[model samples]
Target: MKIAIAGAGALGSRFGFMLQQAGNDVTLIDGWKDHVEAIRRNGLNVTINDKTFNVKIPTKYPSEVTADMKMDLIIVFTKSMQLDDMLQNIQAIITDQTSILCLLNGIGHEDIIEKYASKQNIFLGNTMWTASLVGPGHTQSFGDGSISLQNLVDGHASEAKYLAACLSEAGLNAEYTDNIHYSIYRKACVNGTMNGLCTLLDADMAAVGATRMAHKIVTTIVNEFAAVAKHENIDLDTNEIIEHVESCYDPKTIGHHYPSMHQDLIKNHRYTEIDYINGAISRKGQKYGIATPYCDFLTELIHCKEDIVLKNDPVIN
Candidate 1:
């Protein structure tokens, strides 16, 4: 299978390495000039569970794609806000036979991707994988994660199943799910809470969980998501979701790790996907007549944090 890892950052690189390991023809599509050059010069440098290695995969800039590059599958890992731009930039490679599996964090990516690919060729999913981009062309990947995905339309179930099977052969822990929305929301709860709170406090999951107000704050934020999910007919169980989220705080899991948002906003001074996570929930809450005070506040604070960091650096976009 010829697959393209769109937005080849940390997690995308990890997926590319795994798929290549399974002997698939893999191409990495990214915009970071330094990172792309590093890979082109010296293969992708990756460390998994303390073991370091390199994988040689073809890399491409979206604009530099060739006419012969029609992809069989495109696994999108672009950041939420940049999805549309990445699609437009890579439009030449996407053909009618191409199936898009969006593994982006947060919500509403299917809406954006629909503008590029037909609904029948689109799939929505989420993953529990974790990785950190150490530098250009280098990534440190750790932890275990699974992917759950579903087709947007029933007519495409066979293609979605084949995609899932192919990914599982690469040891990605991929599963075709009938209720992908629930799985996505389940993962989003983790991002919405751990990613946002950790970035703001400059703490890891354990530190946030150690605080006395953890439950109250988590519940407050989760209630807002649940309310919004209800409007979508997902019927989220707030208490169960809260427990699943708090589990990230356990040291045996991801307790001591700062999430991707922290890596983006604090360490790298890049803008985060707050508008897609907590901020998305907050907006949906308003549309659904649900009060999302916590999400609204968290969104404001994250944006404020972004502004402060950008003001100090004034170079990042």
Candidate 2:
């Protein structure tokens, strides 16, 4: 399969390297000049299981993108705020046969893709893998993971299976799921609770679990999210959800990892998917008459702080 990874940051670079190693033709597309230049000069450095390996693949800046090369699949891993512009940048390469899969962590991305790509060629997926860009052209792999995917509401089963098989052939653990929406929400809940708290408290995954109040705070957020999930006709167990969140902190698991929200806030970026995660819960809570004061306050606080930071010192252009 000829694959193009749009937004080749940490996760995208990792996937591109792994797929390329599995003998699939992969190209990485990004606007980060340093990363693209470094990868072009010396291959992408992938660190997994405390070891580093170099994988050579073509990398290109967005401005260099052309329509000459046909892509069977394009994985969208851009930050939620960057998705629209990323889609616009890739218009020349997308065709009727192109499959665009979004592995981003938020709601409303499907609508954005539907506006640009044909519904028949779009797929939605959720991933549990954690990654970070340790430096330019260097990606740190934090955990062993799998992917769960499905076609959009207006899609066909055959397409989902075909795409899943392609990813599986590329050595990515991919599977078709009937309940991808629930899976998305489940992950959202986990991130909403863990990511925000870790960022606000300056804690690592394991350290977050070590504190006495950590479990209670996560329980509060997850239970509130479960209330919203129930209204959407999805059944979830709070205990099971707690276990899933706790597993992230296990020493044997991805223990030393810091959540993306933590990294974003440290970089003083204006956007965080708090609006999609906790903000989504708070929005649904209003409709169901469920009070999610914790999520509400946290979402508002972060937004206000980010607004101040961006206003004072706008992101480097």
Best by lDDT: 1
Positional deviation of 300 in candidate 1, in angstroms?
0.2
Residue pairs that clash (backbone atoms under 3 angstroms), model 1 = none
Model 2: residues >4 Å from true position, as ranges?
Answer: 267-270, 287-289, 304-317
Backbone clash tally (model 1) = 0
Overall lDDT per candidate, in order of appearance: 0.90, 0.84
- Stretches of candidate 1 above 4 Å error? none
Candidate 1 local lDDT, 1-317, one digit each (tens): 99999999989999999999999899999988988999999999999888988978899998898769989999999889889999999888899899999999898889899999989999999998888888889888767888999999887778788889999999999999988999888888889899999999999999999999988899888888888998999988888989999988988767877899998888877889999999889889888888989899999999999888898685664
Error of 2 at 125 (Å): 1.0
Which candidate number maximizes TM-score? Answer: 1
Q: How well is each residue in 44-151 modelled by candidate 2, as lDDT tens digits?
A: 999987899987889987777798877889999887888889888887889888999999986668988987789988899988888877888998986589899999
How much is the lDDT of residue 134 in candidate 1? Answer: 88
**Which 10 residues in a row give candidate 2 its minimum summed lDDT?**
308-317
